[model samples]
Target: MTIAPQRVVTLHYVLNDEQGAVLDDSRARSAPLEYLHGHDNIMAGLERALEGRQEGAELTVTLAPGDAYGLRNEALVQEVSRAAFPMADLTPGMRFQTPGDDGPQIVTILDVHGETVRIDTNHPLAGRTLHYRLEVLSVREANRAELVKGHPLSADVAASQVEDRKVP
Candidate 1:
């Protein structure tokens, strides 16, 4: 059957950035990504590209920043006193999560000075165009449990509806 709402789709994909750097290759992990279609389990660009596709179908698609991780918001960048983070060795690229007005948010360390730390709350891929080479591995009706969970049944990718949002 074609990939449609409530269907579980398994796909092997190679993800790249505008500079042709490999971002993710499912083949290397030997675990294809699986998600429930129309359940907001992945990026819209990927869902649209896989719609109506069948097993073994291969295609390539490019996603604009908006369709992928979305444009970076300047407000997400904040400079706080170094006292804000007291745990562990602080360095660039360190990520931490904290409770926020809209739930938990991840803050990535951008730079650090003697008294101030610069952090970005935006997703790591925000504002970057994404290139995907997709290989449809399988498609089938999702089981009742999977449909209720709003994701696939695979243990490798077990995720709740809230956790599966706008992944590119």
Candidate 2:
């Protein structure tokens, strides 16, 4: 079946950066990506490109900063008192997950000073163009449990397993 809302899509993708440097390859990992269509499970631009495609379809797509992880916001970079962090051995490039206004956000340590620490809340891939080579593996109607979770579940998952997940 063709890809559509409430459908589960399985695809292998080779993600590359602007200079054609390979960033990720699903095939290399031996696991294709699976997501529920129209559920905001994947990037909007990618879903738009994959919409209407059927199993066995293959295509390449390019996404700008806004379409991908989004543009970097300078305001996301800020300095907080060193006492804010619970850890003592702080270092540059370390990442921590902290509660954000929207949800959990990754904060990357940029600098550690005597009394303050600089952190960047922007996603690591923000402000970069991404290229994707995609091959559609399968497209099927989402099962009742999958629809409830708003994402695809593994085939080996049981009914009890689905119920155990803390799905909102």
Q: Best candidate, TM-score-wise?
A: 2
Per-residue alpha-carbon lDDT of candidate 2 for residues 1-168, written as tens digits (9 for 90 to 100): 999999999999999999999999999999999999999999999999999999999999999999999999999999999999988899999998889998788999999989899999998889999999999999999988888888988877736666777687
Q: On residues 1-168, what C-alpha lDDT tens digit does candidate 1 reach at each position? A: 789998999999999999999999999999899889999889989999899999899999999999998999999999999988887579999998889987677899999988889999998899999999999999999876687778887654444533665476
Find the 10 residues in a row with the least total lDDT in model 2.
157-166
RMSD of each: 7.1, 3.8
Model 2, residue 84: C-alpha shift (Å) = 2.3
**Could you tell me which residue pairs clash in candidate 2?**
none
Assess the local accuracy of residue 37 in candidate 1 as a C-alpha lDDT between 0 and 100. 99
User: Which runs in model 1 stand beyond 4 Å of their true positions?
Assistant: 97-104, 155-168
TM-score of candidate 2 on Cα atoms, chains taken together: 0.89
- In terms of lDDT, model 2 sits at 0.94
Q: Estimate each model's TM-score.
A: 0.85, 0.89
- Error at 54, model 2, angstroms: 1.0
